[model samples]
Target: MKQTRTVRQSIVVSAVLLSVLFFLPLAVIEPFRAELFGRETPVEESEPEVGKLDGEVMLQVLNGDMVEEMNLGTYLMGVVRSEMPASFEEEALKAQAVAARTYTLYKIETGGNHGDTADICTDSTCCQAWISEQSARENWGDQADTYAEKIETAVRDTDGQVILYDGAPILAVFHSSSAGLTRASGQVWLNDLPYLQAVDSPEPEDAIPNYYSRAEFSAEEFKSRVMQAYPEADLTGEISTWIQNPVTDEAGSVETVTIGGITMKGSQVRTILGLRSACFEWETEGNTLIFYVTGYGHGVGLSQYGANEMAKEGADWLEIVTHYYTGVTVGPYTPAALQAP
Candidate 1:
């Protein structure tokens, strides 16, 4: 593919246009916690910082009910181990480490919504996923040593480095896979960010055990489910007409889907139906309503599988992240403040 084959410049990065073009009137299924109907921010671009940092940072991380004081280095090890598969390419893993670091700092600066208990949380549903070295070892079994070294190297190689937009840490959100293209943050959330725009995420279409999946619902069951979320929806007529016009965005994912006289975001429908991704198509087969979904996760930021493909094709970590994150710069950063004391 053009994205993987391009000779990426080392220091600067630009979004790959092909990745942002239409893939499907596509979608996300991300581990995001932001409010969908909240206030939106205007999209803006800024110059990212370019420099190096000298010392490690510290953080107070929420691990269940307890908050533990941890160093950036230690926390990132657990995160890379838990969040990404150990078998991914080394450059891909390194990109994940940097993204995790930038996200941590972003959370800290934003006064994370975890009350006042910690700087960040370990819950993958709300924040990033993390696992201790011991648990990682037991899980990896015989390959434990090899995986441990790889994870450590991924973290160490990118220490203090981050992807920045406008001289601060970018949100740095990422997801597992995309439907040939990633989403712009504005399309999925309340804000449109220049660094988080839609881009080509050309990972292998059949790259996994569940890249494509199906969910089937009988007409009665479907009506019941839709009514549960929207009691006002009129799903009484022909099942086919119930899911009316779907308008797609520039990214190729549906922007709005009119279901049973009620219009909602494709993401809202995806949540109600428990689909793998927001990029989906629905069909009626007699009494059954079947949804065909493509990709996994929110389809924003870096596509983990896409990055791995780039790395496999010899693209470095910098190229991997920059391609997915629009126009961003990679550099070392010293936190405005470490984690909350």
Candidate 2:
């Protein structure tokens, strides 16, 4: 009986010792195992919030003395129709849509220059040119349906796409035509933009409407206009001497003209004389100042005629945009992060 009890006790002690031996190593190795093979902390994933402007935008459109609210896409269609000829290539129209959209977004984010109470104005001189769809259709006449379809397709094709510079929407200014080349932003607006650099636009000069325009003014008329703007001018000189030292850019835009002893920028002269473009050459022929002008706009940024020409050459909308806007990327639109104080 004593032997049996001793054997039983020994068996219980061995079992406990074995159990401890097994569990001791496991306990010691568990902590080191985590270090040897990194245990990643479980990260809880939250759902991504939807982006702003979810394919819809609000626009404050100017209608005479009243401001009207319109859908962004609808507004863009009207802008495209009014801004570019409906007869332009589809790719050109698409390019215009993206440009207009980018411009609109930029204006919205940066607080448009029009007014604090209004998002944008219909006045082409103040903001972008906008026209009603009914007016655009009237302009199209027999081709209204076809042209409207094309414009709608272009706008739909490039939906939600914008030209981005450093991840922000570009100003995306466009003009009717260029003087064989696009103007740098600095040359026109005095604000240098990387994407608005001078680029060779292979648009056929003949293809552009009113590519070469001559605006002739009598010497008296020229002097009268100049004097009206710059009242303090010494016009006591030869007619040839009245206009002196005309500085021109590589694109042939007049940078400055010494008129009535006042050095005025080409833009100033263009505005003063109601000229189509700043790219002009003037010479005194008898009592008349014959001004030979080329192109038909401020000559900065994209050229609508040039874009159409590119489209004719098999370049897509993206290619056309990148070509006009140097070093720019066409991508999905994203609202810029607000800068902290």
lDDT of 1 at 248: 74
Lowest lDDT 10-mer window, candidate 1?
46-55
Error of 2 at 302 (Å): 0.4
Q: lDDT for each of the candidates?
A: 0.82, 0.83
Candidate 2 lDDT at 245 equals 90
State TM-scores per candidate.
0.81, 0.80
Per-residue accuracy of model 2 over 1-341 as CA lDDT, tens digit each? 99999999999999999999999988987877857678755689532121234235666777567888765676787788889999999999999998998898788778787565677777778778888767887988999889978987887778778899998889899999988888888877768999999888876788788888999988778888988999998787678788889899888899888988899889889999989999999888887889999999988788999999999999999999999999988877745432111
Q: How far is candidate 1 from the true structure (C-alpha RMSD, Å)?
A: 25.3
The number of the candidate with the highest lDDT is 2
